[model samples]
Target: MNVFVSEVRQLIDRHLPHYVQSLQAEPRLKEAMCYSLEAGGKRVRPLLLMAVLEAYGKPISIGLEAACAIEMVHTYSLIHDDLPAMDDDDYRRGQLTNHKMYDEATAILAGDALLTHSFGLIADAETTEMTAEIKVALISIFSKAIGAPGMVGGQLADMLAEKKSLTVDELAHIHRRKTGDLLTFSIVAGAYIAGVNKEDRLCLEQFGQELGLVFQIKDDILDVESDSETLGKPVGSDETNYKSTYPGLLGLDGAKKMLSYHHEQAKGYLHKLGLSDTILGEIADYLVERLH
Candidate 1:
């Protein structure tokens, strides 16, 4: 799994810059796009997509464009998420955030460009080896996952929930859309590319949902347990924003237990799929164990 992750990361690192460079727009916009895209992070979404592809005995290259597209959307979200009007953080991935490094307007535009460009990348006829039918399917999946009914809706719910106490169910609802939808898209996108049976695709989608819950739970735990330097962003931002989190709603230990439960659930679904490889299981473990 480590080897697979390393390979995907390397491919993403190369492809992201080249894709951005291919754009013939404003130089500053391009610069801001590259800046945020190149900023180091876990690259988890794309890796998950590729891992699923690898698991199904498909070439990782088949999913690379869609994987990169998902990363772009993820990166765009982070850029906007750190704006002065949003999370308002000064740092991300161990460096100044897009809005902090460039002006807020540039950051906003850069994020918008990335978001729209992601769709273009996925739709480009020459970009990937996938059939037009599959490309359209992926675009639909990608759109729904990040659009108003998905991540955007989740973000709004989260913002509205700030400073307000939320029940466990409410919090779960927010995380499922905000974080889980995109993660689920990542897995299911690869499953679609592999032309897996409907049953396997459903199992992978279920696994993705559980994996996303585990991700958010661990993230909440990390905010309280880790430092800003370790997290590469302000720790306790959730608290500062008066946002409800698993750790705040449940004790730290309780959050850990919840995380463990979701982790097991995710692995269970993965096992049910009965893939020939173990990358997806390893990815589930990595998501729970990751510190930042």
Candidate 2:
């Protein structure tokens, strides 16, 4: 798993920035895009996509474009999430957020550029295996995953729920779309590229749902348990923002249990698909147990 992660990280680092630099856009805009994308994230979303390909015995090259596209979208979300109107954070991944490195307006535009370009990457991807039909299918589901019916809508719901009371179920509802939708896309996209049957794809989506819960719950736990040096961002930001979190709504111990429950549930779905011994399962454990 470590080798797999390192390889994917290297691939993204090698290609994503150069792709942006090759663009015929304003230089500053290009720089801003590269700046955020260069941050050394765990690359969880992209890894999930590629892992699905590996599980089906497909080469990573076949899904590299889609993997990179999802990373672009994920980076854009983080950039926007740290803006003044949002989380208002100054640091991310132990460095300055886009707004702090450049400015608010530039940060906003950088995010937009990444988001818009992501679809184009998938739609007109150079992947030899990606037919026009496959490209459209990828784009349709990709758009829906991050658009209004997914991440965007979830963001709005999160904003609305802030400072107000929320139950565990409500919090789950918001995050399922906000965080889970993109994850579901990652898994489903891989299955699509692998040409898996619909039955298997549905099982992966179920696993993605449970994994999403684990991701959010662990994030909530880290917000309380981790510090600035370790997390690369300020701790206690959830409480500072008065946003409902798993740890905040349920006690820390309760959140840990929820995290474990979902972690195990996620593995169960993989078991159903007989992927428990594969990289897919390993990544699930990584996401659940990751400290930062």
Error of 2 at 281 (Å): 0.6
Q: If scored against the real structure, what TM-score would every candidate get? A: 0.97, 0.97
Instruction: State which candidate has the highest lDDT.
Output: 2
Writing each residue's lDDT as its tens digit, candidate 2 over 1-292 gives 9999899889878989987988999999999999999988788888998999888898988888888899999999989988999878898988999999999999999999999999988886776679898899889999999999999899889988989989999999999999999988999999888888999999998998898889889999999999878898789988888888888888999999999999999999999999989998999998877889
Best by TM-score: 2
Compared with the true structure, model 1 gives a TM-score of 0.97
For the record, the alpha-carbon RMSD of candidate 1 to the native fold, in angstroms, is 1.4
Compose the digit string of candidate 1's lDDT tens values, residues 17-82: 899899899899999999999999689999899889889888888888888899999999999988
